[model samples]
Target: MFGSLGAVTLLVSAVLGQGFATPKANGTSGYELKQGPLDTPWTEKVGTTPWPEYPRPQMARSEWRNLNGVWQYRNASGGESEMERPPFRQELESSVLVPFCLESALSGVMGNYTIHSWYRTTFNVPDSWTERVLLNFAAVDYQATVFVNEKQVANHTGGYWAFNIDITDQLNKNGTNELVVFVFDPTNLWPYNVPIGKQKLIPEHIFYTPCSGIWQTVWLESAPADSIEKLHINAGADGKVDITVHTTSNTTTTADFILYEPNSELVKLKIKVPVNKAHSFVVDSPQLWSPDSPTLYNITVKLGSDAVQSYTGFRTISKGVVNGVQRPLLNGEFVFMFGTLDQGYWPDGLHSPPSFDAMVSDLKVLKEVGYNMVRKHIKVEPALFYQAADQLGLMLIQDMPALSTSSVFINDETAKQCPGVSLTPSLDPDTVQKEFDRQLAVMVNQLKSYPSIVTWVIYNEGWGQPWEGNDGVRNTSIDGILTDYVRKIDPTRLIDSVTGWHDHGAGDFYDNHHYSSPQCGTPWYSTPSSPYNSETDHRIAIQGEFGGIGQNVSEEHAWKVAASINAINNTYELDATPKIWNLRAHMILQELEFQIQEYACSGAVWTQTTDVEGEVNGMLTYDRRVNRMDKDMWRRDIQGLYEAAARRARTNGTMGVEGRGGGGG
Candidate 1:
C-alpha cells in the first residue's frame, strides 16, 4: 500500500511527536512541502541519524552509522565537479529531503532533472573509532558518483543494488566532513525503448511517473580494515548446507552454524577455519523449509576480533514427474505454488514506499489474501523488503527487471480490443548483453540468501527482446545463454528463461501467461475442435498471469478518471447498480479454479497484487487502502483448490514421485 503525502505527513508527526510542526513556506532550513501522496510529511521524518534498522538484519554487525535524512541538494549547472562549492551566488534553490526521489513531493523539489544533479551533506566521525568507515548507498538510480570530504570515493551504474566504498582513507578525523553525490539519469532524454516498466516522463496507459536520483536509504558503517565482507549460504536436502564467507582480512577464524526448528533445537556445529574459506556442516534430521510451515535456522559466525550473524534454511526445490506430469518439488515433494505478480509500486512514493512499514504492508496483504508466494515483477526491492518476506514466511519468485529492446503483446481477444498498444521490442545486442549481465549479477549476489526466493525469472514477455522474428514466429538463442548463466551463478534455484507469451522450451519450467479467461494450451486442455477448454500437454503447466478484471472504487481514486484496461471502459464503480464488477471478480476466481481442476496446473500467479499507476487491474487498489476482491472468499477458494489438487495427485497412484509430485510424509 502506498501512502499519500498527507497520510505520510500525519505518520511523521505521530512518530516524531509534538513541536515538529510543518515547515513554513519561506523558512530557510525548513523545506517547502510539496502537495502529493508521495510528498507527505512522514517522509521528511526519515532522519539522518537513526536511518533504517541497524545491523541490516540479513548481515548483522555491531558497529555502523546511519547516514539517511536531510541533505542539501542543488540542480547542477552541469559543470561543477567538486563537493564543496561556493554557495550559489543566486537565490538558494529549494532543499530536498534525502533518500526520496526528486520527483517525489516529499523531496521538497517535486520536479524532474533531465541533466545531472548534486547532493551535499556533512557528518562527524567518532573520535574513539580507529577503523575504516564505509559509505553505502542502498540504491542510486541510473548513474551515481560519490565524493567524501572533497575526494571522489566511488562510482556506480545500476539503480537497484547496493554499493559501498571505503571512505576512512579520505575522512577528516576530527571535524565534520562533507559528502556529495552526483547523479545523472536519462529518464526523459533516453529513447522510449529502454524497457522501463512503470516509469514514464509523461505517465499514461500503464506507464508510471519517473523516479530519479536516490530513491532508497543511504548510510555509513565502520569496520576493521580487514573484515568479513559477505556471506553466502546454500542449504540442500541432504541436511548439509555450505557457507561461503568473503572477507577482506586473511586471518584465521572460526565459523559456527546452528539449526533451529519451531521451538526446538535441531543442530549446532562450530568449526575453526581459515578466513574467506568455504565450510559445510551436516545436520541429522533437518527440518525442511516451506511456505506452509516456514522453518528457519539461525546461524552466527565469528571471525578473529569480529563476528556477524546470518541465517539459512535446510530445504531443496526440484522438478520431476507427478502422475506423469512435471511439477515443482519442495523438500522432495509436490507443493502447488500459488502466488501473484507483485509489481512493487506505491501510489504516493512512486518507486519508494513512504516507510518500511508500507512495504511490509503489501506483503502482509498478499499473505492475507491466501497467496503463499509472490513473483517480484521486474523491480528489485530494498533488502529489508526481502527480509520481511523471509521472516513473514512468504516464498518469492524474483524477476530480473526486463531489459533489452523487444516489444511484447498479448494476442487474446482482450488484447485485440487494444490494437497498436504493444510493448516495444528489439534491443542492441551489445547493450542487451551488458545490461543483462550487470543486472543479473547484482540480483543474484544480493538475493542469494533468505529462504523465500525459490525461482529467478531471466526475462519477461520479451520486453526489449531480440528474438528471431520470422512472420510472427519469435525464437531466441539468448534464452539458453541466460539460463546457463543463472544456473552457474546460483544452481539451487529454478530459472524461468522467458516468462509469458514467448516460450523457448529450454528453461526449467513451462511458463505461460493468460488474462481474463481460462484457455488450455496445445495438447493438454485443448484440441483442434475444443481448443479453449482443456489443459496443455506441457510437462508442467502454470497460470503465469490471469484475472485482470477491473473494479474501481471512485472515492478512493488518486487519479481523477478511471483508467482503461485493454483500451476499454471496462472500469466499473464499486457501488454501481448490481455491482457487476463484484460478480466479474467472483467469476474470474471461479474460472481460475475451473482451470486448475481441469488442467491440473501445478501453480498459478494472479495478474497482480496492487494497481500500478495506469494499470488499475490489481486485486488491491494502488494505495492498498481497499481490497477489490473479498478476502474470505479468496482464502476459501484457494484452500479448496489446494485440497482438491492434492487429492487428485494422491488418487492417481502418482504420490511421492519425489522428482515431481506428492507431499513428504
Candidate 2:
C-alpha cells in the first residue's frame, strides 16, 4: 500500500521535496501528515482521516462504520484505465483521506481542481448484521455518483445536504465490497453551479479556496429492514418536548425515549410512544436552558431494534415589545444576543474540522469570551457542530448559502456595476432557483431540532435570488413568499429575510450590515428614519454585521487586512508594515462595546469570529491560534452588555405606541 510510513516519507519528499520521518497516525488506521501552520491539538490527535467522531450527534446510532481513512484516489479526467474492478483504476495516482477536500492539505492530495475526482475504497460488512446495509454521505460538493462493486447505486446533486443509498442489494455478503465515488464541482463556472457559499476557483478577497469533493464524513450502518430512520425533537419552554420519528418499518414499533442529566450519577427516566405517532413528554420541574446555565437533558430513543442518542434544551424565542422597543425575547424575557460571525473554516480541514474536538474548541472560545450567539455566515456546519452549540448553550443565526445565476462578489466593483443594489447574481437569471429552494428546505429540516438555532437568514444580499423587476432591486413579493415558506416549515425561530442592503419589510427583524466608524458617545437606535425601516410593518432591530476594524497581524500575513482598508474609512491606512497591533485592538473593543450597547439593538453580530483567508477582521486569527483582543479585558465588557439588556427589560416602563414598530424606538 502507498500509505505506509515509508511511503509517507517518499510521498512527502515527492510532494514538497522535503525529507522527514513519517509519524504514525494517532492510534488510527492511517499515517499522519507533516505538520502544517495553525495545527491544533485536535489536528495532531486526528486519528486516520480526521473526523473520527460520530458524524451525526443529533441522530446518533452506535452501530456504524467510520469510513474516513486513507482511500485510493485518481483524477478521472480522460484516464485510460479500468473503472470496474478492484483498485478501480490500474494505476491509482495517489492516496487521499476520505471526507476531506482534495484541495486541503489534510487530505494528503493537495491538488485543487474541479474535474471528476474518483475515490475508491473497500469495506467488509459484519456477518452478524445481515438485514440491510446503508451507505451515507454527510455532504459532497456539487454532484456525486455512488457505485458499489462497479454498479451504479445512487446519485445526488447538492453540496450542503446529506444523501444516502440503500446498498443492501449492492453489498457482497462473502467478502469485502469495492465502493467508488465520482464527484464533479463546476463551482462558479456556470450559472447553475448551486449555492457554493464563498467558494471561488480563482480565490481572492472574500471568496475562499474551493472545497471540491467529499468535504464531510462518509460512513455505513446496518439496520433491521424495518427500523427508525429519522427523529425530530422540538423542545418547549412549558416543561414539554415533542418527538416525531420517521421509521422504515411498516409493522408496529414502539419508540422508547430515555432522559438523563448527563452527570456522574447518570440519573434516568423513560417514555415509550408509538413510532408513527407524535408524542409529547412533560418534564417535571425541568431546568430551562440558557447561555449562563446551559442546562441540557440527554435523550436516548430506541425504536424497535434501532436506537439513537440526542439532547434538547427547554428554551423558546419570541418577538414582543420590551423597554418601549421591539425586541427578540428569550424564554419570554428580553435578552440581547452578543456574538461574532463564525465561518466554520479550518487551516487544514476547509469545511470539515481537523477533529471533533477541534470543532468543540471553537465553540468553547465563544462561551469563554462571554458570547451568547454565533451567526453562522453562509455555511451550514456538520451536525456535531450544532450538537456542541446546544450543549454549550450558544445560540446560532444560520444563513442560507446564497445561490446565483452567476458569480457575485460583495465589493466596490459590484457596487458600481449595480448601483444601490446589495445582491445581484443574474447575468441571465438561471433556472436553478428551484434547486436553491430545495436545498433551503433540506437545511431547515436537517437543523430545526437543535435548540440553539434561533434564526434563519434566507437571502443574504440577494446572492442568487430573483431579479424580476426594478433594475436588480429586491422584490418584496419574492421576499414575502420565501419568508412565509420558511415560516411554515419552522415557526419556532425568527427569520432575517434579506440581511443588509435591500429591505422588503418582511421577516421578524430589520437586519443591517455596516462597516463605518462608530459613534462612541451616542447609543444608536433603529428609528423609522432608517433605510430598512417600514411605515406599515413592525419588526425588531438587529445589527446583523458591523465594525470590521482591520488590524495587520504582521507583514507576512497582512495582505487581506491591507486590501480591506479601502472598505472602511479613508483615514484607515493599508499599512503593509504596521508596527502597532494594539492601536486597532483598542478601537475594536470600543466599537464592539458601542454596537452591543446600542439602545435599539436586540442583537449584534461582529464582523467575524476569526480572520478568514485574506479578510483579517476577525477577533481570532484564521488558524484559531491568537485572540487579537485580550480575552480577560473584553470578556467582562461583553458580559456587562448582555446584563444591561436584561436590566432594561426588568425596568421597562409604559410608553405610548406612536409608530407601527414593536418595542424600542
Compared with the true structure, what per-residue lDDT tens digits does model 1 show for residues 1-665? 00121222233224432221122233345565576642222445544322355424556655555566666676765433432463322223456676677877666676744346777667776676678787778888768888787677788887777888888888888987877788866543323244345565545565566678888877666677777788888887788777787887665665544444433344355555455776776777776777766666666666655666566767888787776567788888887788888888765566777777677787888887678889898888877777677766788888887652323333332222222233443445567566767678778978887688988988877664564645655556778887898898888888878777566665776666656654422223321112222234344666666666665545445443344334324432222322465566555655555555545567778777877655667777775766766666667666655765676566543323222221110
Model 1 poorest ten-residue lDDT run: 656-665
Off by over 4 Å in 1: 1-29, 37-51, 77-92, 113-115, 191-195, 249-267, 273-277, 404-428, 468-475, 520-539, 560-579, 651-665
Error of 2 at 449 (Å): 1.2
- Candidate 2 structure, TM-score to reference: 0.83
Give me candidate 1's TM-score against the actual structure.
0.83
The clash numbers for all candidates, in the given order, read 30, 7
Per-residue CA lDDT of model 2 for 523-572, tens digit only, reads 34333225433234468777777666555565343323334333333323
Kindly report which residue stretches of model 2 are placed more than 4 angstroms away from their true locations once superposed: 1-47, 78-91, 250-253, 262-269, 408-430, 469-471, 518-537, 555-598, 650-665
